[model samples]
Target: MSDSILFNVIPYAAALVTLAGGIARLTAKEPAAPPSPWTPAGRTVLAGASIVLFLHLVGLAAPRAMQVFNASPARLFTLESLGLIGALLLSWGLLTLGLRRAREGQWGAAVAFALVLSQVLTGVYVAVALRWASAWYLHVTVPYLRSLMSFQPDATLLQAAPLVIQVHVLASIALLGAAPFLRFGRVPARTPASVEPGLLATPREETP
Candidate 1:
């Protein structure tokens, strides 16, 4: 299989696993104990997803680097820098979330997992948009901008493409940086171990 297909498989699989885990957590019958801060199943699933995503990012970068020989330096730089930053953020967010969830308990884990997942999904969407845009635009605009930077810097600055890309880059960074903090901010004082099962406890009758 092609590198892109292979690379994509990891994240897709990760996403599937995460979805399944989330569903299981949602449907599980509450135990007698309060929900634990951490659930073994939840941590394992989330951790696996995070590792897969990390590999996916690395896979994504390899092709871009290879394309550098044919592409303009400026365009290549922009793409590489943005991609690297995005990957780093993704890694950090996933690692922090996974580790915290494993150590702290279920609530912490849920918060971290949710935040990281949100960022991951958002990033996937953005990447799809970017890929579509690159293909539809004939891949000329990026290379052209790179070439124009030295000769007609002013004209390039006036173009909207770079600015738009920059916005996306910044937004991605913000999402990564903020996710961890958000998870922490909402953490409850006491972690619930397990929820009580449906049956009610009965009172004993008084002896005669």
Candidate 2:
């Protein structure tokens, strides 16, 4: 009972945090100076993440797709293999962006980068170690998520999952909580590379 509450409360709180942050970001004023344009590395990170994210959304909205893919071990292996590939790309992307953000003294981005990097690293671990989460997601996490959506969240199934899997869930909640504050999702414009003080900063930082 208590574990179920803990599981349910965490994600709801995270949702509120994410919502508030998103609103704040949207309403926030523009910065004075533009930052550096996004490097190819940064863009690559964003692109890979976006694809991975889209895949998740599609899976959630259309469980049948996953069911179709997971009907056989061979099929499930292919799906997990693709997920691993995406995770690796995301790691490379984060590394590329993290180095640049750190060098520019974008501490906020640096922090967000660390949080998400941790999540992705753990995600890779889950993919490698568990080896068939795509199918298990349907059997366990999906129902758990459904319960959360229905306002009667339950961790009953998850409580039985392995410790590393629990850690992955915690990391995911943390990432969701931090989402509203981070600029990782922001895309810089394709304007001229202006060193001007009034130009916008990198997507990770506010302009001067």
Candidate 3:
């Protein structure tokens, strides 16, 4: 597909699905038992996600401020370093969570975890191999995302980005599009009944 359709068209569709899914999840009836409290892996994932998401949101919403922040070499290094740390934590948590889900036969959750793990891994590689991404991100990615938000997506800058960066962006969009069904749309596994249906059968008395 063309870059225009990939970057422009896909993001809007993903965003719409994410928004609708979020609303549906909020209004959906509660399960008989509430979801279990966060496990250690879950907490780790949340912590890392908080850091990573906060930085991305700020960069997207306030590019000029990010530019100013990245202008200082020391500050830029710190930002990139922190981002890498968050990525590491995210990956570790995903590894544990994915394995556990796979072992339990929760294939749907396992797939979600695997996709997210790949997404986080690509992001980590981009931050390292691309080096100074915190600085350059303000120039290309931030603007591309802003244009997307404004309904005037221009992939010109993104087209010029490295293949890995392009893959990272595309993966994120795909994940977003899938969030409704894969993430928020999941249902709890059903437990087996205490008594087997076959065991409940009774023999009829012989006719006199």
In Å, residue 9's CA in model 3 sits off its true spot by 1.2
Write candidate 2's Cα lDDT for 71-125 as tens digits: 8888777878777787788888887777767777777777777778888888788
lDDT of each: 0.46, 0.76, 0.84
Best by TM-score: 3
Local accuracy of candidate 1 as per-residue lDDT tens digits, 90-173: 555555656566566667655656656555554444445555332212243334333333433222322345445434433344
How are the candidates ranked when ordered by TM-score, highest leading? 3, 2, 1
List the candidate 2 regions with Cα displacement exceeding 4 Å.
Answer: 32-38, 183-208
Q: In angstroms, how far off is 59's CA in candidate 3?
A: 0.7
lDDT of 1 at 191: 54
Task: Return the TM-score for each candidate structure.
Answer: 0.28, 0.79, 0.83
Of candidate 2, the 10-residue stretch with the lowest lDDT total is 184-193
Q: Rank by lDDT, highest first.
A: 3, 2, 1
